[model samples]
Target: MCARSSLIAVIAALACTLPAAAQEPVKIGALLSISGPFASPSKDMLDGMQLALDHRDNKMGGRAATLILRDDQAKPELAVEAANRLIRGDRVDFITGAGLSNIMMAVYRPITSTETFLIGTNSGPAPVAGKDCSPYFISASWQNDQPAEVMGEYLTKKGVDDVFILAPNYQAGKDLLAGFKRTFKGKISGEVYTPLSQTDFSAEISRVRAANPKAVFVFYPGAWGVQWVKQYSQAGLQKKIPLYSSFTLDEVSIQAIGDASLGMFATAHWVGDINNPTNAKFVKDFRAKYGRAPSAYAAQGYDSIQLIGAAADALKGDLSDKNKIKAALREAKYSSVRGPYSYNTNNFPIQDFYLTNVEKRGDELVLNTVSKAVEKAKDVYAAECPMK
Candidate 1:
C-alpha cells in the first residue's frame, strides 16, 4: 500500500510538471544597429517595445513573451547571421529588424522561409512592398517612400519648380528619390547617390551649388546626417538653398547639429505633438521612461509589439498555425499611435504624413508640425504586390 501511494504521488507530480513545460514562453528576435551610429534609435525601439510588453506583464495570449536582442552593427552579413541564430538557435516566433534597407534585404529571405512572422518597425524597402512581398512579412511603420512622396508634394505646393536630389547609392536611397518623383512635378538636377555613411559632403554640396536648383533635398540618416548637415551649414549653402530632407534629421540626430537643424523642414508619419489619447500617453510615458522625446521610429517599435500581441490573441495563443496568424495580422486590431492604422494589401501601413519644421524653444530644439501634407497615404508600389 505504501509503494502504490508513492507511485500515485509521483504520477500527479509529473502531470503538473507536464503542463508547465508545455507552456513555453513565446520568443521574439530583434536585429538592429544597436551599438553603432544607429544606437540612439535602437535604444528608443527597445524602450517602446518594452513599454508595450510591460503593460501586459511581458506576456501575450496568456503565455510569457521574451525579447532577444542582437546588434547587427549596420552590416549586411551580420544581419544575415543574426537572423540565422534567432530563427535556428532561439526558435523565435517573431523577428524584427534592420534599420537600414540593405541589411533588411540581406536577412529577409531567411526569416520568412522559416515560417516566422517578420514585422518591421522601420526600414521598409520597395521590393518587400511590391512584387517580392511575403505573406509572412508585415510593416508597422510607413514604407521608405511614403514620407518622401509627402515631402515632394509639400515642396511642389510651395511653388518650387526644379530641385536637386541627394541620397545614398542603396535600395532605400533609390526608393526615397523614386517616391519623391512619383508625386512632385519638378526637375531632379544633380541627382547624386553618395556611398552609404559617407561623411564629407563638400563634393556633393559643390554639385548642388553647380546645379543651382530651386531647392536641395537629401535623405541621409543618423550620424551620416549629422556630419552632412554641419558641413552643409559651414559651406553656407543653407543661406543660398532651402534645405529639406526625409529621415535625415529627427529627435535622435538633430540635437547633434544644434542650431544648424533650425529652420530645416522634413517629413514623417508621426511627430511629437499629434493630439490623440494614444499618442499623448505614448509621449508622456516615453519621456518619463527614457528622459527624452520619442521619434517616429520609437512609435513604430511600440506598435510592432502591440501588433504581434493582437495577432497572438486572435489566434488563441496558437502561434503554430501560420495561416491563422497571418490572417489575424492582416486584421490588425490595436490602438495605433498614428490615430488609426491599417495594412495595405502588401501588409505595409496605410498612414498619413506631416510636414515638420525644426524650431527652437529656449534650450531645446523641437520638431513641430507645419501641417498635414497627405491623408490616409498609401504606397505607390502596393498595387504591384501579387499577394492575394
Candidate 2:
C-alpha cells in the first residue's frame, strides 16, 4: 500500500513539473554586427525581428518568448565568441542574425553542431548552401550569390554585352562574382577584387573608365557601398557606365548615398513595394515602429522570427524535441514578407527575385520593383547540397 501511494505521489509531482517546464520562455539569441560597417542594416534587421516578436505579444505558442542580442562587431572571432556564450552560457534554443558572410561562416559550426537552431537572418555564404550544409542550419534571407545571379540574367536579357565587375575580396564577394559569371555570357571588360577595408575607390573608378565597359556591375555592401556609389557619381561615371549592382543599393545605403542612388539598378528578393498583405502589414507597422522604411535585411530578420514562431507554434512550444522542431521548421508554412517562401533541398530559401530601380516617391527615395527578374528561383549551390 505504501509503495502504491509513493508511486502515485511521484507521478503527480512529475505532472506538475512538466507543465511548468513547458511554459518556460523560448529563448532566442541573435548574434549581429550591431556596430562596424554593417550597423545600419543590422539595426534594421533587429527592428524587424522585434516587430515580429511584438506581433506575437512576446509569446510563442502560448509561452513567453525572450530575445537576447549580442553584437559581433563584424568580426569573425568576435562572432564565434558571442555565439559560444549565447549557446553555452545563455542556453538559447535558437540562434539568428550574422550580418556578414564571414561572421556567419565563423559561428555556423558552433551553433548548428549543438541542438540550437541557427536561422540566419542575413549573409548566406556559398559553403553553407553547398557541401557544408547542415540540417540544423536554415537561411531566412538568401544565398549570397542569388541577387547577383538575378542581375546577371537581367543584364543579359537587356543585351548588355561588355561589363566590368568589382567586389570586395572576401567569401561573399567571390561567390557573387562567380554567380554573375555563371549567368552573364558576355565579354568581360575587367574584373577587380578590392580589399575589404578599402574605403576609397578612385583607383577602381579610374580603371572602370579606362575599360569603359558598356555597363558596370559591382557588389559592395553597407558603408562600402555608400562610398563606392558616391565615388562612382563624383567621378562622373554613373551616367556613362550605367552602374548596376547587387546588395549595393539598399534602403539603408540609399539613405546615405542620397541623390547618388537615383536611377541606379539592383537586384533583391524583397523591395519595399512588393504587393502582398503580409508585406503591407510589415511595412506599415515597421514604419510606424521604426519611423523609416525597412530594408531587405529587415525583411529577412522579420521572416526569421516568424519562421521560429511558426515552428514553435506547430510543436505547441515544446522545444525539447529537436527533431520535431527541425521538421516543423522544414514545413515553413508561415506567411512570408517575400511571398511563396520555402526551403530548397539544402534548406536555403527558394523564392522570387526582383529587379529594382531607385525612384523618388514624394520626398523620400525608395527602391521600386521594376519587374520580376526570376520567378521561383533556386540557388545554384543547392545541387551540391547533400541534404534532400
Candidate 3:
C-alpha cells in the first residue's frame, strides 16, 4: 500500500511540474549586424523589436520572454556561426533579425532546415521567396524586389525614357535591378554594380555623368546610402539629373544626409506618415522610447515580434508544436504597422508600397508618403514558389 502511495505521489509530482516547465519563457534569438556599415539600421531594427516586446510588457501569450541577440558583423560566415550557436546552444524558439540579404541567405538553410522558425525582420532574398521557400522561414518584411518594382513603375508613369542605375554588387543589388527592369520599360543608359566595400562613388558618379540619362536610380542602404547621396549632391548631379531610388533615402540616412536627401524620391513599404491607428501608435511609442523616428527597418522589426507574439497567443504560449506555430504565422492575426498585412504562399508579405519623398518638416527631415505606388503588392516570385 505504501509503495503504491509513493508511486501516486511521484506521478502527482511529475504532473505538477509539467505546467511549470511548459510556462518557460519564449526565447527569441536575433542575429543583427551590430558593428558594421549596417549598424545604424540594425540598431533601429533592434529598437523596434524591443518596442514590440515592451508593448507586451516583455511577455508573449501570458508568458515571460527572453531575447538573445547576436551580431553577424554583416559577414556571411559569421552569420552562419551565430545561427549555429543560437540553434544548438541557446535553443531559441524563434530566430529573427538579419538586416542584409547576404546574411539572410547565409543563415536561412540552417535555421529553416532544422524546422526552427526564422522570423525575418528584414532582408528578403528572391530565391527564398520563390523556388526555395521554406515553411519554417517567413519574412516580416517585403521581398527585396518589391520596393524597386514600385519605383520602376512610378518612374515609368512619370515618363522617364532613359535612366542610369547603380547598386552594390550583391544578391539584393541584382534583385533590385532586375525588379526595376521588370516594370520600368525604359532605356538603360548605363547599368553599374559597384563593389559592396567601396565607399567612394566618385567613379560611379563620373560614369553617371557620362551616361547622362534623364534620371538615375540606385539602391544603396545604410551608410552606403549616406555616402552615395552626399557624393551625388557634392557632384551637383541632384540638380541636373532627377534622382530616384528605393531603400536609399530613409529616416536614418536622411538624418545623415540632411538637405542633400531633400527632394529625393524613394519607394518603400512603410513611411512614418502612413495614416493608420497601428502605425500612429507605433510611431508615437517608438519616438517616445528611442527619441527618434522609426525607419522602415524598425517597422519591419516591430512587425516581426508582433508576428511571433500572435503565433504564441494562438498556441497559448505552447511553442512545442512547430506545425501549429507556422500555421498561426500564416494567419498573421496581428495588426501591422504598415496597415493591411497577409502572407504570400511563399511566406513573404503581401503588402503595399508607396512613393516616398524626403522633405523637411519643422527642422526635421521625414520620408513622406506621396502616393500609393502599389496596392497590396505581391512579389513577382510568388507564383514560382512550390508551396501552396
Candidate 4:
C-alpha cells in the first residue's frame, strides 16, 4: 500500500478505538527549525508528520486538523517570535515542533505558559523532564539523553573504557554527556564542548588522537553530524578509534557522509530496520513514497501526529481543555510505530533505545538497528520530577 493509505488506516483505526467525540477544527501550532544546519532533517520530520495527517484525511476525533507552522530558522529569538505568533496570532490549541533542544527551550515557556498543550516531536530537554517538568509538556520523542545512555551501556558491555566526549555547547549537549557519564564508568579522556555551528573539528580531532581514548562519543545532529563524521574520516581517525554517537548519524545524513560514516555506531529510539508489524508498514510505505529510508527523526515526526490525533479523538477534538488534552497524551491512546510507549509520571516517554551501525543497503549507506541496547528504559531524572 502507499504510505498515504497505510497511515490513513492506522490513524483511522486509532480514531475508531477511542470513544467517539466531536468538535471544531483542531489548530496545531508547529515551531520548527526549518533552516540553517538542521534544514534537511527538519524537512524530513515535517514531511513525516504531514504524511500521517494526509493519510488520516487531516481529521482527528471527527474534527479537522489545521497545522500552523512557523520557522525558527535555528535561532532563539526567532523561536520566541514564532511561539508568540502561534500563541497570540493564531491562538493554536496544541503546540508541537521546535526540533532542536535549544529552540524548544526558548519556545516552551511562551507556548506552555499560556496552558496550550505541547507535544515534543524532538528535543526532550533534561530539566523539562526532571525538575522543570510540566503537566502540559509531553514528549512524543525521547528524553534527549536516553540514546547516549544506551550507547554508554553498549560501550560498557563491549569492555571499552576511557572515551572522549564531543558535542555542541548547549543544554542538550550537556544533558547528553551527563547521561553518558551516568551509565559509563570509564574515564573521560577529553570532554570537549565546541561552539554551536562552528564546523571546524580539526583541533578536536587532534586532541582526540593525542588523548587516544578507547572511543569517541559525539552528539551532533543534521549537517553538523555529517561534517564531523566526514572530517573524522579525513583525519583518518575513524579507522583507528571507533566513533560512537547519539542522533548524529542516520539515513538522512548517511548517504551524504557516505564512506566516512561506514561502520559508525550510534544510538536512537527508532532506526530504519526493525522487525515489527507497525515498523514494517512504516518502512515499506515511507520508502515507496519518499524513495529513501526514514530516519529516526522522521519516525518521531510521524509518531507525534499519531499521538496528537489519538489524544484529540479521545478528548473529542476539543483541546481547549488543556488539562484534558494533557491527560489524553499521558494515556497515549495511539499505537506508536516504535511499539508500546506510555508517559512516565514526568510526562516523558519511557521507551526502548537501540544500537545501530552505518552499513550499505544497496548503493546507500544507512544506519541499521542491529541490537537492542536498552529495553523499555526509563530515565533516572524521572525521580527528580515533582509532577508526579
TM-score of each: 0.94, 0.95, 0.96, 0.92
lDDT of predicted model 3: 0.91
> Residues 97-195, candidate 1, lDDT per residue (tens digit)?
677788889988888988888989888999999998999999988799988899898889888989999888899999999888888897888688998
Candidate 4: 10-residue stretch with minimal lDDT: 17-26
Q: Alpha-carbon error at 265 in model 4, in Å?
A: 1.0
Worst 10 residues of 2 by lDDT: 15-24
Residue range 201-309, candidate 4, lDDT tens digits: 8999999999999899999999888889889999988889999999888788888888888888889888767767878888787888888888888888888888889
- List CA RMSD, all candidates: 2.3, 3.4, 2.8, 7.7
lDDT of 4: 0.85
Task: For residue 335, give model 2's deviation from the true position in Å.
Answer: 0.9
Candidate with more favorable, higher TM-score: 2 or 4: 2
lDDT for model 2, on a 0 to 1 scale? Answer: 0.91
Q: What local lDDT score does residue 240 receive in model 4, on the 0 to 100 scale?
A: 90
Instruction: Give the per-residue lDDT digits (tens) of candidate 3, residues 301-335.
Output: 99999999998888878787778888988985898
What residue runs in model 1 are displaced by over 4 Å at the alpha carbon? Answer: 1-22
lDDT, each prediction: 0.86, 0.91, 0.91, 0.85
Ranking by TM-score: 3, 2, 1, 4
- Could you give me the TM-score of model 3 versus the true structure? 0.96
